[model samples]
Target: MKKETIKAGQITIDFLLEAADTNGAAAMFEFTVPAGAKTPLPHYHEHYDETIYGLSGVLTFTVDGKITDINPGETCFIPRGVVHGFDNLKQNDAKGLTIITPALLGPVFFREVADIVNQPGTPDLKKLGMVMAKHGLVPVVPKR
Candidate 1:
């Protein structure tokens, strides 16, 4: 399988291992979240669990209404169906490695997101939601 490096909006993801390379056991990737970058919205994955290990700097995560800071050597586990989002609130960039069990998500999802978000005009949130839904990621919609 080809290992791909993708720039998805404010983050860069380097795919290390994919489903085809691991017999569908897991998909692993390294990611860099630039300073001041935040996830567009909290989302939940219904088909897989994700574990993130911090490599450098600090990354702040909000999971199910709780906030946690992951520094170098620290880890965070987001279980399937749990709403979670992350951001780099520090002055420096944050690096992390993530593994998704069952290998349900891959580069394609990020690539699609990059395409939408990188467009010249404002991204269509509805279209973005559709892409996320296609990959089993359901973005949380804010209630009035």
Candidate 2:
């Protein structure tokens, strides 16, 4: 049981268990977002289903065309192919555990994002998006 911490933009990800270490069955990570932090753009995982369990504060999750407020101790799921994303909109920070099944791309995506953002200079948005695309994520256009 090895753990890794990765910084992606304004989020801190603690890899609890990687799918690769589990034969591609599942991956889990603890995510912490600071107050007023930025969030992943709206997107969908082409091959993995994600389940998120709130651990502290509040997080706003958007799936399909709906938005739900996830509070402490609550959980939600987004099936593969659903347009989804989340943000911490509360005055305090938010933390949660996210699990991805079928483990197709979760670990890779986090690693790439962390690498890109932790580099010497500013992170290239286009490059990050390309990396995400290669790992089976489709970024959705944000609503106006």
Candidate 3:
């Protein structure tokens, strides 16, 4: 019944509502990724599917080993267990909305990442990986 706004990483996250907390699902969100900002390294969830709709500017998404450019009105679906990550590649910030199905632990994941980003000192990649693992997330290693 209430909305929340969080400034994390290079994005200002506006959470609309908790769609299904008991089921770990959330509704739409206004995600603003600042220019030149990149999301966390490619990662995947074993039980969640993420769909992204770009609202403004351009978003570069790297899924598996291929890269795709998404602009306003564009959409991309990332199936469960697929490695995916994105970044704002334009001079202006990119705005988008992402929906995760079966929610899984996505909300928890976002909060954790926000905490790490706000912590002092450079983020420790290894520790972050551990934190992600606790929520069934696995980082995708680039192909050789």
Candidate closest to the true structure, highest TM-score: 1
Cα lDDT of model 2 by residue, 7-118, tens digit? 8878998888876677989888989999999788899988889999999999999999899989999999999999998888889999999888977756567888888877
Candidate 3: which pairs clash? none
Comparing 1 with 2 on lDDT, the higher-scoring candidate is 1
- The TM-scores of all predictions, comma-separated, are 0.95, 0.91, 0.85
Q: Count the clashes in each prediction.
A: 0, 0, 0
Residue 17 error, candidate 3, Å: 3.4
lDDT of each model, Cα atoms only? 0.92, 0.87, 0.77
Superposed by TM-score, candidate 1 places the C-alpha of residue 58 at a distance from the truth, in angstroms, of 0.4
- Model 1 C-alpha lDDT per residue in residues 21-133, reported as the tens digit of each score: 98999999999999998567888999999999999999998989899999999999999999999989999999999999999899999999999998887888999999999
TM-score of 1: 0.95
Give the Å shift of residue 101 in candidate 3: 0.3
* Candidate rank order under TM-score: 1, 2, 3
lDDT of 3 by residue, 1-144 (tens): 326777767777877545465355545566888899857778888877878898998889988768988899999998988889888877998888887676565455567778887777787788788888987789887667
- Colliding pairs, model 2: none
